[model samples]
Target: MNDIGGSDTIKPAAEAGRVTLPEQGLWKNLGQADGLESAAQAWTPLMFGQLDCAEAVCVFLVDPEGGRLRATSHWPRTRMPAGALIGAAEAAMENNRGVVRGGVGDGGQLTGGLVSVATPLVVDGIVLGAVGAEILPQDQTDLRVEMRRLQWGAAWMRDVLRRDASMADKRRYSNAIEALNSVVNVAEQKDIATATRSATTALATRFDCDRVTIGFQRFFRTRVSAISHSAQFNKQMNLVRLLGAAMDEAIDQRGVVIWPETQSDDPRATHRHQKLAQAQAVGHIMTTPLYSRGHFIGAVTFERPTDQPFSQDEIEILEAVSTVLAPVLDEKRRNDRWLLSKLGESLGGHFIRLAGPGYLGRKALLVCVAALTAFFWFTMGEDRIAADAVVEGAVQRTIAASADGFIAESFARAGDVVSKDAVLVRLDDRELTLERLRLLTELQRGQIEYDRALAARDRAETQVRRSQIDQIEAQINLIDKQIERTELVSPYEGIITSGDLSQSIGAAVARGEALLTVTPIDAYRVTLRVDERRIADVVEGQTGTLVVTSLPDTSFPFAVRKITPVAEYADGATSFRVEAELTDGFDNILPGMEGVGKIDVTEARLIAIWTRPMVDWMRLWAWRWLSLD
Candidate 1:
């Protein structure tokens, strides 16, 4: 009997009755009537109950050899005849579907004959076995229903078979993995000759091949360097030469090649390989190419007896093994054993691979890096530094108290647009008016007294009245000026930015005290708070755009007018207060409206523009560590 891994194992047919169904419940159609006899015994009873069949039902499964079908139950021991529904069962298994052959006239409940239904248990497209059932006489009225019920039972059997096949495949896969690990361990050996001999021997042992040869590329041609059975062989030997030629044939094709090729799917060049295998009486042959640094480096060929041709799974495993050993073999060819040398070789190999052809992914990445380097090195872009900024009027003037008086009424407040000389606040003027009237009456009396004194020839009286008249005139002029100042007016046609004397009505204000700040709405300057480190790049006349949060959709262009040497601390950073005037007016720009500004400096390479910060930091770091005298 052949085991799951295609290895021959000895087990008595009677022993199969002892094995049981796997613990993991059944899945798809892997059970050709379920696993060997013991598995069938476990499931046949349940299928019998669910299928509405007669008491006697038989399930026969195909043996692993695929030649004969064995009964799962103790059916051969029973009184059932060989010809009893065996044809129907075989038909179902062959067709891979359920079949109901006996019809109403052929077999009916009235005649005491029950219909027979059979179904195939298939898994992964291979028919494993089939189940035959004799429908209950009463339930056999409709052959279609009986067949459907039998099919459902067969589907369950298929699930059971599928599970068994899956477990077998998994076991086989594990064995393949272990074999690969062994070959890989040999490849890891430092000495090339020893590793090659050991790996070849291991491959022959694991794969049960008659011969295994390792060939390497020399001068663009494959040369047989190692053979599994013997380290020393005559190159002049016809068999050895033939094997070398076969390996080279596979290597030149640049892919996995199998001799006695089964696949009509691929365009095959296995003529030399097949001829050599035939001449040597080697049954099967396969060669897999190895690649290193994105170049074809060598090939490993396996030859076995006629019966054990390479399966797709084995071919796949060998291909993976080739890939795993390529780099190691390349390094071994260099004959370098030092750790640092090996590391450098590995890195160099990677660089070569990146620079090599045929690998689209690595090639694409190299192209991208080169393009980016050129773009950053040769292309020039604007060098701009961002700064926190706010809009302010070009000429912001403060409205001050004109005279010492009490505020009476307010006409406008901050943010109010006012015309030039527009009244902003009214001050009390009744006292000034009364003082003006008294001064006017005193002035008239003083003038009359002066004239009378002069006519009566009194010089001293005339001098006193003349001095009083002059003093009275001065007092009246002062009262007139005080009265005029009662109404505080805007200095210009602009918006009131600061003063809000609405709540301070009737409050006394001293002369020259700032009452309001009015700024022209049309003229605006951006006060930029540039970081001290970047302030040097923000000299006067540098032009850029300003974008405020309020009018974010619009960008106002501006030029640096002045850079304040004095620094201010805001948001935990020290920045110089730089002033920039807008080259173009914005209606939305207002005093104290904050936004961010970018100042353009001389154009520079994109690499320099992006990496300036890192370069500056490195310079600072170098300065910190170096003490150059």
Candidate 2:
């Protein structure tokens, strides 16, 4: 015997009261039966007659149509088999193997001296049904032998069931192929309306439907597009609206819907379908949704007489046809539209997906982009031209060396505040002092000679002496003025903007050499290096703001005072010099401070303000290389 729980199990046949029949005779008798039920009925009794001590025998066959197991035949036809025998049969079928229970009574307790044996009738790994027998065996040996006999007899049942199943499968396959061919033929039409109309008509004729209608989803609603047996019909008609509503119901559920639904089908909302059926006086109606690329696209509805509800096989075939026709129909519909219409529809579909639920991350990104675009498009801002700027002085005065001498003393350096007449630099004044002393001595001697000449009353001598004294006096005065020039001083009360003489004490200085630069403390101007591309937008009297590097937290308002015509080239770029005067906020501002300045030109859109540079560059590039003939 093999494993009994889930595999074939058998034992030697008992010798006592076993009526053996020839294999040839048994096969011939089984063949004589007309069908599975008849064969089972004949084989059940034969097996019971051969096995000794058998109480009752029954055969269960799987219904090919429903795929359910039911009792086909039983021996001693006066009464039903015991519960234990039926249980064994079902167990064998469920387990797909032979089962043997010994000493089990009707209640499934080991209190009786009876034994039940069941063997499943399997073909091609499919459990067709089972055969069960209750026997009053003499002993364990007899029970095993009865089980072996039952297993052997199950072969006939397996054959019968296999034959029936094969024939049914062949018929379903042939029907499915024929239905597919019909759908393919209909799809040969070039346009959606024609194809849909032909498809509905063909389906109605082939499936014996009274009417057939097709509808497609448009703008989230179902619209009837075609009807069988009619070339054109009013879409606004009550009947057509009802048909569309029914199609919508099916599409919403994303499954096939049938009126007068079967008990085995899942429950679905079908109010529209019911209403349509009642208004149209159609007894049997079925609607199945069409899908393409995993998206619901449309639906097809079929109607028939009350007596002819659709069969499972027909329903399956129709579903197959729908699968084949959906993509073809959808493609044809798309191709039939005008180019502009196609583009609009495509965009509309994408917009729908974007606006609908789901795609949270993408939706957020789209919202942000749209917000930015709207802000740039509709918002107005100052059209300002940005340029590099440096704080300068309104009037710069350079204090230079007055005489050629060594630098002797320094009173001020760069960045120092000073008043008018403040000594900024001093050259060596020793040489001027010596020359003045010599001239003074000569003047005294000449004066003494003049007095002597006057006392002697010599007129010629006196005149000569007087002339020499006057010459010496004039030279002394010249030396005194030269001494004064050696000391450099600030021209006004201002800051020393440049030049440091303290570090260069004792260094040689020349006459008129720039030793220090000074500018009024309260007067400041800003010079901006405006790019040539943007220079045209800048002009005198245009007010702007300036932020210097030294005082970046504060901004000084300025008005453009001048724009130089000359262009300056530096660091591989061209710019123009623009001079602007600070209008206010001069406190803490100093010359030579550099930062960025923006000159306001006019009011403009924010997009233009931000993208002006790039747009200008692109325009220039196109003009240079993409010039048209």
The most accurate candidate by TM-score is 2
TM-score of model number 2 = 0.43
RMSD of each: 39.3, 45.5
**Model 2: how far residue 583 lies from native, Å:** 68
In candidate 1, what are the lDDT values of residues 375-458, reduced to their tens digit? 899999999999988888888988787888888899999989999989888889988898899989889999999999999989
- Each candidate structure's TM-score, on Cα atoms with residue i matched to residue i, is 0.39, 0.43
Q: At residue 96, what lDDT does model 2 achieve?
A: 82
Error of 1 at 58 (Å): 99
Please identify model 2 stretches exceeding 4 Å from their true place.
Answer: 1-50, 56-112, 125-129, 139-149, 345-629
For candidate 1, give the lDDT.
0.75
